[model samples]
Target: MAIKVLVVDDSALIRNLLGEIINSEADLQLVGAAPDAFVAKQMVKQFQPDVITLDIEMPKVDGLRFLEVLMSARPTPVLMISTLTEAGADATIRSLELGAIDFIPKPKLGVAQGIEEYRSVILEKIRTAARSRVKTQRTKVKATSHLSYSSTEKIIAIGASTGGTEAIKSVMEAMPPNAPATVITQHMPPGYTSTFAKRLNNCSKMKVVEARGGERLLPGNAYLAPGDRHMRIVRSGADYRLELHDSERVSGHRPSVDFMFQSLVKSAGSNVVAALLTGMGKDGAQGLLALKQSGAFTLCQNEESCVVYGMPRAAVQLGAADKVLPLEAIPEAMIQQLEKVKAGSRL
Candidate 1:
């Protein structure tokens, strides 16, 4: 049976376009289209859709408000449709925190042109959302006592997708103020990465910023790969700096985890700690394996704690990860592994 999807938007044009795109896919069935949240609530009972494509702005009730209600009540997979502006980016990130599976940016151009341009992305998000597990209750992250460690030469590389926003936040919050240099690649569109990085910065003791080319890596700070760019680590004498460039998408993502991990395997080798977090696809598996083979410490998030286990599952199957840990346990695992590396180096 085809995956059943419902389209919810205040605009008739968007509703029609979404319906058309969904109908065009052989594996997707458009169950219903609602112009507002009021209509959407009724259709949810009537059609019983497998996934919902929600617009952030809607008549009667807003998308975020409705999403909160729906997740609390029914816990269905929801993919948000948002504009590509700064305000849109912030709202979309909030939606993810509210249990949305993912979001796609609405084109800035006219509806018809934008829909046609982003048809593939929209369809793929729907498929991914349909297969995702929706949680009614989000994990509450408690602030733990921070560990105090002097700056070390270790670098931590992390990659995440689907449910990574919260997962990354949990790990970052648990880290000490003097945590080692960190690099991250989360599958997000262009406008949202800066906001995501800022949000992470606010919650964690470490400084977090979106990677701009040529910035030197510093202990106690994390660099997030900017959307639409591939970020690689390069050595500058005895120090490390980032190189961001436009490149073909790897594993279906531009700032791919594989790209960053492979670069680390070449530059940092045994000095790196890499973790593959929750995501929907196998983007980081091969690069993680390469990192492990190069003597870097590698870890993967366990399935039970994952929002979507695709990436970590691939790494585990490929024998890439040295440890498989729950979300709450990964920070300590990384710290322990890094300490082991430090001890071995002294010996």
Candidate 2:
């Protein structure tokens, strides 16, 4: 059976164009098209599409708000379509937090020209999203216990991409407010990291913010890699600090997870707990292996809970992860392990 797709956009032209593309592929079938969220909601029930292509801005209700409602009612994989401008990037990031599976930037030219330019990308995103399992957790749950850190210096380092927005949120929400300091690298565009940070802060127990140069890696705080720059761990006296650099993109991502993890291995060494989460690529796997070799406790999100099972799968296959966990269990497990190390230090 062909993968069913629903195209939702405010523009009639875009709705039709996307439908055409989806219907063209033998593997994908265009189940329906809607001009707005109101219509889209009804179509979802009627079409029962395997995937949805959603626009950010629309009449009556915006894409993000509609997505929230849609996921709550009936969880389905969604692929966001946004303009490539700075504003569009910002909205796209917000949509991710709201549960979009992935996104494709619309072109800057005329409607037809724009669609033509991004045709392949849009199709590719839809194809990838269709294969992913849509997981919408209805309840918040934590692991059996929290880790007790005897030393105040323990830190958590994490990396993710693709379906990471929701995945990261799942892990962070399950953690204690007083958990160890955390450093995260999630692939994102410039001007979007702040919004992502804010969203995470709103939903999580710990203080979450984008990393600023020279900021102290404080206990119970989480710092995200700033977009457009590489973030690395640096030691200052007895404390660990974040060093932001305008370096070349590694693995096609600025704020590369591999670069950050490799640096953490050098700066924090065995004192760090490294985690490789769900993503579409192998960027973090090699770095995670190095972290394991350097004596850092490493964990990878298991395939069952992962959006793509790419990065974490690579890490596990490379013998990097000391433990492989479900998405919802990662935070509590990390906290517990950190506490274990801390308790040992005090002994």
Candidate 3:
């Protein structure tokens, strides 16, 4: 049987294009295409699609509002169609928080040209969404008491894709004010990381900011690798600073988890705590294994808590993760590992 897909976009061109692309795939079947949320609501009830391709900008009922309703009533897997603008990026991030599996940016040129260019990406995202786990209930994170560890000279490296924004927020919010200097690489496009960092900063006790190269790492602060760049950890004397550079895509992503993890292995070595979270591919598996081999305590989110379980599963299979934890348990696990390292038992 083919995977059922519904395309919801205000633009007839986009809807038709998506419909064609989806139907072109041997494993996919286009169930319906809606011009607005009103039509989409009816189509959703009638077609009961396995996956939905939603446009963020819709006429009457916006995509975000429609998504909230859909997740509440139906809870189907959704992939957002977004423009490559700042406002579009912000809204797209919000959609992810509301349970969208992923997003594809619209081209700056003509719709037909863009659709043709993104043919493979659109098809792949649909397939990925079909297999993804949709979270209907949001996890509420409570503030925690601060840990008293000396965060100086200790570093934490994290990497994720797909469901990473929410996963990163959960872990960051659970961290106390005295947490170690942390660096993160989440697979996102260029215009979105700043917005994502701001969102994380609002929820987290740590000051979360998009990394600017050459800034020294400080405790109680988190540096997010800016999108479209590879962020590396470099040491100068006793201080570790961020180094951001434009690079060819590695493992299909710039600002890749593999790049950051490999950098930590070279610079921070055993003084690091690294976690490879929920993502759709094996981007960070080998790098996490290298960190583990260098004596760093590594963790991967277990299948029960993951949205896709691809990256973490890969890391676990490669003998990289010292602990395979749930999303709610990972922050505490990191703190425990930090305590062990501080106690001179490891690192």
Top candidate when judged by lDDT against the true structure: 3
**What global local distance difference test value does model 3 have?**
0.89
Q: Give me the candidate number with maximum TM-score.
A: 3
lDDT of 3 by residue, 16-129 (tens): 888889888899999999999999999999999999999999888899999999999999999999988889999999999999989999887888998999899888788878
For model 2, state the Cα shift of residue 296 in Å: 0.6
Displacement of residue 220 (Cα, Å) in model 3 is: 0.9
lDDT of 2: 0.82
Q: Tell me which of candidates 1 and 2 scores higher on lDDT.
A: 1
Residue 135 alpha-carbon offset, candidate 2, angstroms: 1.7
lDDT for model 1: 0.88
Clashing pairs in 1: none
lDDT of 3 at 16: 87
